[model samples]
Target: MHGEPADEGQYTVVAKNPVDKVQASAKVSVCTKSKVDKLADVAVNIGENARIQCQYSGIPISTIIWYKDGKLIPTNDQRFVITQETPTLSVLTINNTDMDDKGVYSVKLTNTTGDVEGKVNLTVKPIKPAITRDLDTSYTGTKGEDLILSIAGTDNPYPTCQWVKNNTELTPTTDPRIQFKENKKTNEYFLIIKNATQNHMEEYQAQLINVSGLIKSKKNKITIQKQPTFIKKLQTIRVNQTDTGKMECQIDALPQTRVYF
Candidate 1:
């Protein structure tokens, strides 16, 4: 008698006695089973609003319940809202969806006859693409030697990278001695200076550009080493034999080079 139209009708019961018969009659009303509409899955970014809805049909609806991950959800929470569009439609709204909001959501409808339940999945996407750190650049280049200035950066979404020296962007040059290379695996950029000289010594920095905009890394103070040079030649002094004397010279050098007398 679950859902048979024929089962819906009038029924009568009669008791027969020796001389007279009495009968009782009543009408049977078949209550329709509660039917719940399926809910669709939702995918949204963090800090965005999300809505899940379902519809039910029955003779009389007792209550509508909403649950998240098998736990009953109360409307007291400010972030959650339960609303009824019509007698048969119910909606659950989540304000400012976050990572914690990602889960299975279910809605149930109960009536005097029966109850029905439906579920939907929610996915909240995370935000990324911001630069985290730019390691400090510090390198000492020996004069007339191949030198490298490496800049390391970290970011969620990969970005366009470049090197800047003396407030100017570095690019491919006709000079084969000078080269620029990028290490995609490590997210690092390298600037190689061949035959490094005083000219190549300058404040070097790394720059990153992406949809978020341009971001610059810490400056790298580059220093080039040079051989020592005498500012004034040693002075000659005529000394008697076996007399103790000292020879003095005025010199200038980078990195404080050791001087031999």
Candidate 2:
């Protein structure tokens, strides 16, 4: 016999002969397979809690399970909390989410009739940018040589990097001698100065900014070293046997220089 909602009731079947009659009664039940009705993706910041909810429609739900990236979520894990507020609602909470917690989360609902599954994507955003590798406090380069300042770090959603020299921002378009470069995969940034000169010697810093926040590197000084050069040649003078004569010469150099006769 076909099963329907209206057929869910007690019934009796009788077999009667000329003088004898027999009857048996039974109850019928109607079952419906579960199906996911609503589910949504969730995004949360690092160190924050993430909540994923699933809404389903069905009858006689027998079991509910949660999974991450196709692996069953362990109930013993303290970071994961699973709850069913109602027969049709299921919730999963992840406490203190980090980069590893970001993945595809799914819910499986089972009933006497059939089982249904639903999934949601979890995204964990990183906090403020941090400098894993910092620039040196001081850098020295020879004049007319190439110099490169580099910094490495981690950041979410990527970040805009800027080079600051003596309080002035450095850009490729504004300064032809300077070039800025970044490697997204490595999370590294670079400031390149071609044919380094005395003008490039100054305090430098790197500023990183994104939606989360801004971070700046420590102040670094770039010194350009130059070889000593004679500004004035020695002068020759004639003097008598008892007469006194003087000879003088001028020299210029970076970091100052000592003169000897």
TM-score leader? 2
Name the candidate that leads on lDDT: 2
lDDT of 1 by residue, 106-146 (tens): 87778887678888999887554344556456778787789
Q: TM-score of predicted model 2?
A: 0.58
**Cα deviation of 219, candidate 1, in Å:** 9.5
| Model 1: number of backbone collisions | 0
When superposed on Cα atoms, how far off is each prediction in RMSD? 10.8, 7.3
lDDT of 1 at 258: 75
Native-vs-model 1 lDDT?
0.77
| TM accuracy, model 1 | 0.47
Which 10-residue span in candidate 2 carries the lowest summed lDDT? 56-65
Residue 153 lDDT, candidate 2, scale 0-100: 84
**How far off is model 1, as Cα RMSD?**
10.8
